[model samples]
Target: MVTSEWTGPFDPSSDPEELTHLLSVLSSFLSYRRHAHYNGTHVRRQAFYSLPSSHWSLLSRPPFSVLDHLSHLDDLIDQHAELAEAIFRVGFAFLAPKLDSEWIGEVLGGDARVVVGDELKVYEKIMDRLGVKASKNDVDKARSCIHQFYREWSAEGAVERQKCFDPVIRALEEEFASRARCSPNLNLDRSEMSVLAPGAGLGRLVFDICRAGFTVEGNEISYHELMASSLVLNHTKTAGQYTIAPFALNGSNHLTREDQFRTYQVPDIHPATELASHTLNSRVPAEERMSMATGDFCVLYSQEDSKETFDAVTTVFFIDTAPNMIRYIEAVRNCLKPGGLWINLGPLLWHHAAKPPPSEEDKNKDKEDRTTDANERDIGIADPGSVELTNEEVVALVQHLGFAMEKHETGTFETGYISDPSSMLQSTYRPSFWIARKK
Candidate 1:
């Protein structure tokens, strides 16, 4: 169950570095309105300034029609700006009230005064309280996270979710169906089946599994995703209550201005309403049916107590994020019971494949660099410990680690990750989809 205000999954005050990072993340959401407007208007207007004064006269005419194009672009940018503002408001609504004066003072340093005159009063107030600035990269990541909402919660994302999630859901149902056939009188209880989804970003897959009549837990490492997912899963009261312009910031490859400025209502269905029915036939309490865990997947689940803890494990576009793919396979193997299914759908797009080796200096960094080092490891950035493997080798390693391949399909389904359908440039992945059972 969700509280009136989410304090977050862990106590930020426990670790000074982590507390600072959390405050930065919260500040990013508050700062996003200014960043979005600046990027949309000021930065883009510079393009027009680049052309010569006389050249504008010729370009503004019929064939080129620079003036008309500029007008249309301005409208699109405005539309996007509005959407960015909405995202910021939603983020603030979930996070801001949790801040107390003591927590705010830590981030404020000495002077508590923040330069005034932000458009949104609430936005300015939080900015003043935190008195910390989000890095450019962190703010950019916060913007990218908005696009993820369209992929995971909006109706526009349903097709992509169907392609990526359907097979895994089916595999779980089929596994239990087979068991049910053997015992006609005592059919397998799906309520007893517990599934784990590591790297469960935004939690749509985990919610889908719960809707499919099984108890499931989603484990996430990214704070951005956790914040976004928590808002949708816990605070949301109805379908289409929240609206966001996903394509507002992304301007290139747009077939039309309308396409670039497209908006969508999030959580096509109410999360709680859809899953509330799952409790009627189950022994688990309504709250226990669905849960989210925050932390590193390997560290949290790759222990002796976690061994054989879940009836199934599901990974969607997840495994390749590992520095060593073997550790991911080992973790999955460790968590599942004997004969438990490990359903996976993803390409081996190794996140750290292109990263060069770390410098000798980095290998022997001082104590002050510990915070930076720990942050790098949290995001799965390539380190001296990182390794990359081929698709064939990954399947082989899963088998070697006590899992038997029951189904394997390569290049069968072409999937898109947070893709804008109307955009001219489409990046699609023909992911490796498979189901393997623990021996």
Candidate 2:
């Protein structure tokens, strides 16, 4: 059973009531993560409300019950106007300033009035935006624009968003603090290698590592995410040098935006004093210190010619999204030098498949199951379990690719369903954390 442990920025002991409230909020947040559209204004109104109560009964249970609840909810969400509105509201709240006004207008305009043909057109556009190539006459077509937007937005930042992850950060700090005391060996200082975080959404983990004195170079795939990470990093660096001032005569919080301004502190490179000094004085701005590349990971990896070049490579929730997992993995392996490290933190259990059939058994099964299981399989092609490697498989693959296994650990973030008892679909698949060294 998951335990409730307080270890974040907020002082739990100072106010028991506030702690309870925080826990409740965290639980609600996790529920949203599991079935982001469930009970949403749009979903409840359009379709979920009409679903038989029997369909949602499994939500009260465990294991695959969340799936059952969502399956039932999907039917109601497909039909009811109220449910659709609820979904829209939930999605809007999550997306906030990022929700495109034009998209919202189109969704509201098409509500209940969209023709099958129009829906198909909108669906195709949405799929294209998601990098999904849809074939004509495919029954497992793209979801509506509204659905696609919500899913993408939710996946991008909901859990990783700074505000939502405050507790999670605290929990990790506490865990590390305890481990540092018990396992002295784990207390090694940051290595000389620089970490390249591609698609570094919000940079929460990156910031943490930097605070621990590691040099991190982050490249966000989106502008919004890059801006957010910059803002947060600036705040963190400033906070380190200043203290909160007590309210003056006006009784307003004395902290002002001006008080927060300070020269941003970039990571100090050890042993490379000349290079470090040059990096600091270089014309490239601190925000742009790490060159941000916007494009697909496979393309980015392919452009590089060196094998065993970097000291370390980090990817979070990235491998599962790769169109070609083997190619991606091979590229990553090539990028690392002998003794270089590759650290990945994400759910390895991809919901979709990544490659094509490779064996006789798979070929026979693919033919038989293609019709019924198409949607359940990989979105691109039927890869015979060789493309998307499982966590164990990944470890083995890395070893086979000439990497020495250093460490592997699994831990749940507080933002996940494991901490939220009310969540219907708590992820059963554990997020794997791997640390491997190139041989």
Candidate 3:
């Protein structure tokens, strides 16, 4: 099981917490996110590992939910580890800006040395630093990232991300080559292309791009994610080296695969190893090729020399998180070079879409406050679905903004909340993607 201390970022737009206890709670959350000693054994709840799904339909049709494999406690560890890591990273992104490298290394890098009122101490320190209070609702709203952890930032879900960009990468190469043909002086192979992936969660796509031999910068606004990612990247020298993070599922009993009835440790995660193969190819190792910056996507490059020079600007499941999707689109367009690629893959769930207008027929009836207490109403929170556009509508907007649509696709991608092959918490999104060039 993962320690809930780390793995969430701060986003106050949706009212996660009130102002009063926010910093204290944040400190408490960060304290727990760090690893601690339990009964003299070191537990690494920070590192995320994927758990295998255990389904019983292995003997049945193509959509077998059961695993035909054997068992180990590793399966349970993986799913839980993944969730733990996500939460931990969220805190990492939050704390990164407040603490410098050495201080962070000291806090997040230690064993469970002192456990006395650690949360309180952390909270007081945070309150002192922030000079403000953090309410529970605002904190709760920020906590929503947990529900999205697996979908946007897990290895199992990575293939879906690949689907979004592989086509664009191919197009980029073709476009560059075509341009070179027009001007003999233009050298296609002389320089590496640069890409900017804003709000890059956990940097998996950033790594994938580096492996493909591009210079990439992954930008994040959250200190939690930035710190967590930095920690993961710094500690993981070899692929699968940090194997302590394990996983298991909740309902393995339903699986028909006799062996899967027991928990099984999934395969190893080789993030660092993936970079190893590409390291030798260039003077800059693959790991070095992938850079990260902590700041807002809109203003981070607004005054810098970095804008208008990137060969590509890629966003995956990112724009939907924006307070205003238009701002993100405008930012993307401004930063990319002329003829550069703007590759976007995500749903149109607009974070700032107002609730649907009340109908005249229902005007007389006062709508109930859905967040009423448990005694007054059912103990369920309202879904914060965004007011997003249809894929078609979004593409039209891009075209109007001077982008030439080169490719588009609509398909379904399933993302698992837990790695349990048998659990039913996973979800599928019917989303659209576009690969357009600035005309």
C-alpha local distance difference test of each model: 0.74, 0.42, 0.52
**TM-score for each predicted model, relative to the true structure:** 0.83, 0.40, 0.59
TM-score: which candidate is best? Answer: 1
lDDT score of residue 396 within candidate 2? 77
- Ranking of predictions according to lDDT: 1, 3, 2
lDDT, candidate 2, equals 0.42
Q: In candidate 1, residue 94 scores what lDDT? A: 46
Report model 1's TM-score to 2 decimal places: 0.83
Tens-place lDDT per residue, model 1, 321-354, is 9888877887888889888989999987887775
lDDT of 2 by residue, 1-439 (tens): 0101111222332456433332332222222322334333345444544667776555435653544444544443343222222332332233234436686456546456445566433433332333322222111111122122221222223343332334333433443455457678754333333455555654544544344333555544332343333333432232222111111101123243222111111221111222234443323322333333333454445444445556567776666665456665676777666666676767765645644546887677766766678544332313434445667877777788777876676665433321212223343445676667667
lDDT of candidate 3 at residue 433, scale 0 to 100: 68
Q: What residue runs in model 3 are displaced by over 4 Å at the alpha carbon?
A: 1-155, 176-191, 241-273, 279-284, 302-306, 355-387, 412-421
Per-residue lDDT of candidate 3, residues 277-378 (tens digit): 666434555654677775667655544455686888888777767654555667778888898898877666665567555565544332353334443321
RMSD of each: 4.6, 18.5, 12.0
Better of 1 and 2 by TM-score: 1
After TM-score superposition, the amount by which residue 244's alpha carbon in candidate 3 deviates from its true location, in angstroms, is 9.0
